[model samples]
Target chain A: MPDVLAEALEQVQREVDGAFDAFLPVPEDTRARLVEAMRYSVIGGGKRVRPLLVCATAQLFGVTRQAAVNAGCAVEAIHAYSLIHDDLPCMDDDEMRHGKPTLHKAYDEATAVLAGDCLHALAFDILTMSDTSNDPFVRAELVAALSRASGHEGMAGGQMMDIVSDEQEYDLQQVTRLQQLKTGALLAASVEMGAILGRVPPEGRTHLRAYARDIGLAFQIADDLLDVEGDEEKAGKALRKDEGQGKQTFVTLMGRDAARAQAEILVEQAGQHLASHGADATLLVELARFIVKRDH
Target chain B: MPDVLAEALEQVQREVDGAFDAFLPVPEDTRARLVEAMRYSVIGGGKRVRPLLVCATAQLFGVTRQAAVNAGCAVEAIHAYSLIHDDLPCMDDDEMRHGKPTLHKAYDEATAVLAGDCLHALAFDILTMSDTSNDPFVRAELVAALSRASGHEGMAGGQMMDIVSDEQEYDLQQVTRLQQLKTGALLAASVEMGAILGRVPPEGRTHLRAYARDIGLAFQIADDLLDVEGDEEKAGKALRKDEGQGKQTFVTLMGRDAARAQAEILVEQAGQHLASHGADATLLVELARFIVKRDH
Candidate 1:
């Protein structure tokens, strides 16, 4: 990873950890179990990439670091819930995440499902309650954007399509549409949320969204590449599971060389979008490159 | 049922149905499936008790019926999601609800789960999107209240307690605590949401909450009684399943006679709270009676 990108990741991880630490106050009854489940699911450990994107996007729009922290944490909450539910027996049926038994394996499936549900709700609650955003309109916009991105038309819809599309042939456009809704929606929302907080102009918002869309696609391509070549332990999952499941992937549609070429193009495009915003986005450009080149 | 309560129930059903029909747009892709699941889960079934309370509470505060419609719909959405998830294999494991095969049985479990999750998210999305309330603070309050009621400290937490308690003996206080959190939280939220929309004074909010809490407990008591005396076909579920499962219930904790007596007292208290709001709450008082006296 580039030094700047690595530093941003470290900073995001630290902030996310701190933010989550303050959540789920110990209820007088069942304090231990509830807290443990929350901690286990969140502290289970991952790349913290979503939170990093949220923070980086916010920073790109000249928002204070604190202004973006809760939004960053909220995205992490959504990400964690998706992982938990996805690992359930009726879903992906995975027993492990981040090299540890998933929440259901650690707790019971019922508790894991409830935990995920609670976490999903909590994400919105946290976002709505953020103290940093003084403008109610800004807060409302942030909530609306995130809710849409997380709801049926975005992430959930993409997952449904994925489930229905398994083992089916699809062209690059279809694949791009799926990846944009599934992965890019939230990433784009993160940037938009930051821009909203910074009160960025409409032109800046458009550029930020373009930047997010290109980087989001590049990130997915890199993920596909990693699954084909990355270490299983570091990836915290079975490598090539998508291939095993006969799922469509960027590399499957485009040859590895072509996929790599496309990713480079997207990174360059994202950087160009950032360039108009001046030096403030220098690190964001580096982060985009790092995201498309990382092994895990 | 009292004539007024019967009329209120019919009105609430029509209002809720209309609200849902207006709010859920048919997305082009998953329009059929989404509408099917939504209609199956929502229309032509189940008591409209929660929505009625929302409408009634708003009436008590002299808010226009149109202002409370979205809040009413939001509560029903949460209620539907709870029923769907509760019937999952890992949760209550029930196959029936409202006299029909549960969502999971009607659809597949994964679809049911996703539908429930989507509905849960959709409720808040509706609240955030609702233009009925011009005050942003009121909107935020409604969102926060609903989130708390649904999250770990409320409905889901109460569910966790229920799974843990099972057949274990608990004192009356503990049982009441469980019921309050599990069933009462959302019921209370329904009433509170109306107040939020109406922008009721703090004192009025307290009285409205008391009215809801009493009716909520009475509603649960009536449900327990239905399990004991209900016809299998009419209830649309297997009667006595609660008894068969050795679950802790109001009927189990207190004898049927005592439980019935408690229901009467709760109804009276709810009526008393409504009295302060005058004849405008006449229908609400009758609704409370209907809650305790209903067969199914």
Candidate 2:
């Protein structure tokens, strides 16, 4: 990773962790368990790639770092909640994540479900707070962008496609559509929300949107590659389940070398979209390159 | 039920159903099933009491019916999603809702989880749209109110308390606190959101807040009463499960007669709080009474 991008990632991880720590103070009552479960998954873990994306994009428009981080936390909350629900027995049934037992495995299934829900609500709650943006329009737009990316037509819809992937023989086109909704949408939203917080009008966001789109697809392609070739310890969770389940993936559909080459080329294209921003876009450009390079 | 309240309920029910039907158009692809499950739970069933609360409160401030109905649909979406998740096997584990198979039973657990999530996201999506309110502050406030009410410190916290109720010996105060978070918060938000949409300043909302608080408690007491004595067919789901699980409730702690009387007293007080609005508050006053009177 470039020094600038790595430093930004580390800074965001600490900031997000601190924010969640302050946001979720475990109550004295039994509700403590629910908040604890939420804290467990949200406070730490993951690469903090999404928050970095938000911060990097926000920096281009001179948005305040605090405001950008707050919006980034909202995106992170949605991501965490999706992971919690996705790991449930009825879903992927994963036993581990981020080198720890999944929420359901650590806590009970009921607590996991409720914690996931609380986090989901927390996403909007964080966005609407004045701390995120003093301007109500910014806050409202942030809420709209995140909700659209994560809702039925976005992340959840993509998840449903994934759940049924084994039952249906999805081709490359179908898989691309699924990944676009499942993973691509939220990644794109992270960049969009940052621009919204910066008061960037919809028309001015084309380059940023293009950058997000290319990276989102490359991120998934890299994920597919990781599933087949990455070490379990490095990934911090189960991998290769796609192949074991005989689910069609980018790597399964395209040859291994071709899939790897596609991710690199997409990363290259993603960086080009940020060329308009020049040096100010250095972190974002580096981040896109990191997407395909990261083992996890 | 009073004629005014009955008419309002019927109107809000139809409006909310129509809004959801419009909001969730089943897609042609695999996502069709996810949207289908959401539609099944949201498009019909339930009392529509929450939506009516929003409409009645908005009426006091001369908010447009279309705007009020749209906001009401947002609240109803949150309510519907909660019910879908609450009925999941890991949670309440019921088999029926609105006289039909629960989402999980009608669909599956994974679909139920995703559909509930989609509806949760849909609530914010609806609020952010211009149809709810052209003013971005109103839209942001609506998001803030609904999210805070439905989040960990509110609805989800209450749900956690309820799940752990069987293991703990909860007293009347504890039960009240639990119900306040679980059921009362959303009900309170319904009224609060209506006031928000009408641009009612926070200080000026004292009486409306009082009305909402009173009725919120009353609603839960009546729910406890129904759980103990209401018919399954009329209630449209399982009943008497609180007693079966040896859980402490209003009916259990206060004695059925005292609980019934307390609910009636709350309803009376709730109406009195709306006295400032006089004839304009007729539907709200009647709605309070209906809370305790309804069989379901």
Candidate 3:
């Protein structure tokens, strides 16, 4: 199962990197700089979770793997931009991301900021420019979906909630709702984009969304768990920064043991969603486990 | 003619502000803050040159005025974001904009930077979401045109070039090319978006592009001329900061007298484009005169 997930991840990464590298505008100096910032933030590091979800969900409907690649690239671009901005001085204020200096720390803050902005715009640009999509309506739908996921109702809004609610206690339901918007929206978008490409049935779309939502929550919980007990070096940054910042995490709200148990249950539920889809979702099931069970 | 232009400008302000106010998202405090940054940068009082151009061009082809309002807002959003980012510490490092502290100064640098990014994305959001344009293909074209205008080949790329070439002795041609991509690209996009909304003829689009390009250069040159002899209070900025920074402008590359002469010629050429369009271009002709002759 782990081998299948690994193979899917590798394929998604190769295709996404190649497609992005090919599509980036060329020969202009400033464009080169923009592209470099994009490349620095995206290539050769971090788990390709979003892109893998796109590929796996498409495969569940027997869609051609090629069909998910562009959508995968689009989601990754959004994810990359989020990470870059999240690490900025005003946002998360982290110096290192994925074991290296954040883009702002590596380059200047303005470049990091502009690079993130360009990448966000470029995600929409790539979706709109996709020749393979064929249907303008589908393309428009994809653009609208991704924009909603990135905008006020989704990631940005969620980040704001997180900032305002830092160090504050909240009930499980409130915490869950916040995580659903912040982390789950994009994860949900990844699966939906793949389903859109696969032309999945409405029922299947609903099931897959639930699956994504569960796994997304589990992923965040697992991250909080890791921060509590994981190695600082292996975790890529200081392991206890969240607690240091008084950020409310699953571990903070619930005990470490309860959070771990909850994450395991969520992962099981995610697997059950894929079970009905059979061998088509074998990689997806493995991904769910890996997402919650991985050390780093 | 000037009275007509003034009335149109007044109408545009009311409509644009109303549309923007209505479309703003709710319930998300951070997103609202981002929107506030956008509204601050956009609605806070500057010459609405780009939005005016978009509206005037749409009017020239008998498009409904409401159709122009959304595009006007979108163009202003892009323009506002550019100003916010340009005034950042890493960019121009300006402390003031529109007689107020720059966005970075008003907010923190990171929020200001993120605000600019969000505003740029929001521009496309507004464009695609506009109800006036029912055609997806037309919306796609508008997105593409604006992206090209704002992306590496457009304003942002032009800005990078300007930053790199600052204080260097560039000739008049180089300066013109830089300004065209930076200032002129958005100006051209405004006109093109108007043409698309109006569903204008190909020849009409060409003429509008030509007119916009000329006016764009003339606009920059007039700015250079103003910087040489303008009032600081009215301009809302130090009068000679461009010269003080050793930046290359039309006045710096060519003599001030020559720059003024060139602006007049470009304005005349721009008016000639309007002439070819006949009575339809009456408002645009007046706009050209106002742009060249305005103090701020």
Top model by DockQ, which number? 2
lDDT of 1 by residue, B1-296 (tens): 76778887898899888878776666665334644676688777778888888888787667778768777888888889888888899998888888889988888777777777777877877777746567767777777888889888788888877877763666778878888988999999988988887888667677788888998899888888899988888778767977887887899889999999999999999989877668888877888888887777
Q: How much DockQ does model 3 earn?
A: 0.44
Query: Measured by TM-score, how close is model 1 to the native structure?
Result: 0.95
Order the numbered candidates by lDDT, best leading: 2, 1, 3
Lowest lDDT 10-residue stretch of candidate 1 chain A: A26-35
TM-score of each prediction: 0.95, 0.99, 0.92
Fnat, one value per model: 0.46, 0.93, 0.28
Which lDDT tens digits does candidate 2 get at residues A95-170?
A: 9899999999999999999999999999999998888999999999999999999999899999999998879999
The numbered model that scores best in TM-score is 2
- lDDT over C-alpha atoms for residue A113 of model 2: 95
Worst 10 residues of 2 chain A by lDDT: A1-10
Lowest summed lDDT across 10 adjacent residues in model 3 chain B is found at B25-34
Tens digit of per-residue lDDT, candidate 3, span B117-183: 6667677777777485777776766776787788766787677668767635667787888899888
Which has the better lDDT: candidate 1, or candidate 2? 2
DockQ, 0 to 1 scale, candidate 2:
0.93
Interface RMSD score of each model: 1.8, 0.5, 2.2
Residue B257 error, candidate 1, Å: 0.7
